[model samples]
Target: MLERLDDIDWERLGHAYGTAEDVPEQLRALRSPDAAIREKARWQLYGNIFHQGTRYEATAYAVPFLLELLADPATAEREELVGLLAAIAVGYDEQWLPDGLPIAEHRQQAAGGAELLAAAPHPGDDDFDEDEGDAEYLASLSEDDQDRLYTHVVVAAYDAVRAGVPLLRTLLASEHDLELRVMAGYALSWFPEEAEGSLPVLAGAVTEALEVGATAADGPDHTVLAATALVAIGLLGGAPDPALLDDRRPLVRWGAAIGLARAHGPRADPAVAAELLGWAGGESPSDDRVPFLDGDLAGFAGQALAQLGAGRTVETFDALLRRIPAVSGVEALHVVGEALKLAFPGGALTGDVPFDALDERQRRLVRQLADHEQVWRIDGSYFGNFRLLIGEYGLPDKYVTLRSYAGQG
Candidate 1:
């Protein structure tokens, strides 16, 4: 049977293309000569091809196979099979079984399957349970095992928000594994209003995170979670204290920036906004000795400044613009530049109009500044470059010399 099944033209089924015409042939092929062949055919037809078809085709062919998979324990690669079934269920909205199946039996079977997947035993464990003590027991496992347990719980929570949130909240509140708490906090963000009451809990977690010195260098997930929770709290109408923004820890500072940006309101204190603008301008006291600034924090500050209209002054605008080019990465630079452009209408270099239009002495200052021989050679070169590109095509040598001389001095 296996050899014959192997020989069958598994690849030739027109259903592979996911067209309606292919559905009947694919359904017929589902009863292939070998069980393995049948499973493979059903897996591809229902899981992949059927999902792409129209609602009617999906309901007719795909739903039945997924429903069957949802009930069949014999199909024991639990995780992969469960994931595929969930995808089908979500894709086609097959929350209830087809007409012929008794509703009660269908509900029981589906719930059993979901629960089994949701509460799957850790690889090293002999048994798993969904009873009261199970969570406590799972929570007490070794760090690696606890991580695995949380992963399963989080996936389950993601699938069924109703069941998932409470479990996740419990995990968020109780897990000693900072990683698990971070994961729960992140997972909680997906169901914002449902996780609304958890805001204080999450905030407390972030506050504790700060107390413990959580840093971005720790890991991306940790940084994202800490940042996300802060943003989440702000979204929930929580007011963040300004002191949170000036925390001694960089992670907390970055998170506060993200939170404050999201919390856009008239209530944002001008003092705090001024401080954020100062941070973006690279005037924050901590920046003087720090090897580098947090590009994300700097970008957030620029955004907040623009939103608050703090980039009005030439000095302030130039300072913010300077930070844009100084940012380490392209994405960071783009974000800061965008905010700068929005806040300071004309570009970063806009300075006060010359008190008196370029006079001979002022023109001389410009020339000195432009000439390479000037004390500030780079400044002269900058003006020289600008003059070559923007100044009139040709001017007298004395004018050019004066321009260079002025710029140099």
Candidate 2:
């Protein structure tokens, strides 16, 4: 790895700081015996090379060295290295937003700062149809900004993974280290074309997770890694094992539901689909002092199911609506993403759900939101989708009172 580093013109390669000359030093520091120096080096490498999850020219160049570091027995904090590899490999997913959000304004709204606006639209308003490009509204920026930000990152990740797949597959198969193995699987999921090499290992991880989850009462030390393994397996087009779906552990069940949804979409096994729906509605299995419903399990499950366009679009939407503004609660956007997934398949979840051909209920939802005329506080593409749904499908007229929108601006 060091020999190869000498061949690259680091001055021309770009990370966040505009050049990659300093990256080699950070790579060497990974082998340092000084624990503090090694820690700082890893952080510096991550911040500059993989800054804000955006991959750069230097990122792909760094993958092989990262893998080499992972294989070396002399490396300290190997688990952290595995994590960095996963983060670097994972640039983003297809459903990922194309543009950055105005997070500052959203934060202000969440802090109770409201933006004055025209009176909310009522049912009998003059313009019942929510126009496509309201001058007052800003859509997910003209696709151009998104294209500029991510195209190279996607190319960089793909090029690196395409070359590194064989090495990662070997590492995943032969490594005795559990974290390294799990991370390898996670990284491979980012490159679906490499599934042939990674799926078997992911499948093995599922079996191992079932064993761990089955005996979770005895501490379940590896459940988190196991969950990551399961999710990775699912993302790589592997179906959830029956044993996993049937596992008594709620965590495994939640992960299994996500896997099945990814692998089979709505065509997933009847039992698996039912189980996923239960998860979407925030159900927990086996009472082993587990807190499945109290976390993002339901949120992820709901999103997957929404993508599948299953039976619970409205039911799931209602449940998500009920959970919003719960002072101390999970994210409402998770369910919003799910509701949009099902409610406006190929449209709603991404904020492109149209307003034409809508029945009364969808229309009413739009009208009611317009009546409030409050500036939207949420600033995600998903939130944009939710707003479109209000205009497209029309949220219920009483939507505001239905869930507290306080701190939601």
Candidate 3:
């Protein structure tokens, strides 16, 4: 399928590593009959071209080949390939979310960066370590060079993955593999520009999911398929079919609520906001992680609230306060961090301040946290991010110090 794979000069391009010469072999290995070999190559791609959501010059070049592999019927791990393309296109979903991808801004920055880079002198080989990777080489560059190069490569990678959105749309019709369709739908959500063509396909997928959910009562849970499509519909600037908001499955209902809230904003039904708040409260927790919002439904709800500009609301604050004591795992980290940021904007807390000096919001937050000491008593690893987040706001990161600061000690 990749007949012209060797035509490109991979060695000239750079990924997260030094050179992208290894990318070609990794691409070829994706078609390997041995699962282990294919998996090893997948990890190689993840660790190099798309390392930690940082796309590189070689990332753009890899897009077409990855799409080809995903399109090939014989290819394995096509789902993972779809996810990789999504990651390359938008990095983390939260970065551009609430307010979707700033395509115009990015395009402008990329154009400006291209101009700046075109006139700028390229760094000499001596400026880099002999064994330095692309990231290290980037670190050695001037701030302007760094921004220029980053914008240049990032936008290129974004557009490269975007070119394959049509192909990704076709995967949504795969009848048997619901997960594959879900992943494709999730990937399609990032490309809002493709909304004109993709919206129909996504809406059709949701209809199909509804039909599946209706007749296949004894079959697998297809709620995710509907959820993904609804979420994508919202992300693409269209609200989902409003009736799905009352779907029997909580996840389906949550998805519809999130879609309505995102698409219609302040004009959305007030009930939708309440529904999302309920989800945000973690009232009926589930270990079943959906593909969207990092698989944490509660975290997704909380983030959606943040995106809706309701993060600072008294209702949101109270809901998050109630959610904290019971929350566990990495997902809670996002929820807690969101609550703290909304409560104490821009590091307003000081270690030396008396409790009376704090604002009502800050005092209320500290008092609630002080009351819920179990959140602090959880395993230390659970609060690694919690501590960092609290420290960022110039607040005490320990339970004892927090109680003292709240004058509750």
The best candidate by lDDT is 3
Candidate 2 error regions (>4 Å)? 93-153, 174-176, 212-220, 283-295, 325-330, 340-409
Report the lDDT tens digits of candidate 3 across residue range 14-108.
Answer: 66766788999999999999999999998999999989889877888899999988888789878888888888888887676555687767776
Q: Quote model 3's TM-score.
A: 0.89
Cα-based lDDT for every prediction: 0.43, 0.56, 0.77
- Candidates 1 and 3 compared by TM-score, better number: 3
Worst 10 residues of 1 by lDDT: 92-101
lDDT of 2 at 87: 64
Q: What TM-score does candidate 1 reach? A: 0.39
lDDT of prediction 2: 0.56
Residues 1-409, model 2: lDDT tens digits: 4667788777655567656789989998988989999999999988988887777667878877877777676777776776677567554332331111222332333231111112222123453223421223213334543343345454555455556677667666676666666566656666666677777877776676566666667653556546656666677667767567776656677667777777776577767667766765653322222122223565666566655654646655555443333212123445544444444554432333344545443443334333333322344222443444444433332345323322122
Q: Order of candidates by TM-score, top first?
A: 3, 2, 1
Q: Of the candidates numbered 2 and 3, which has the greater TM-score value?
A: 3
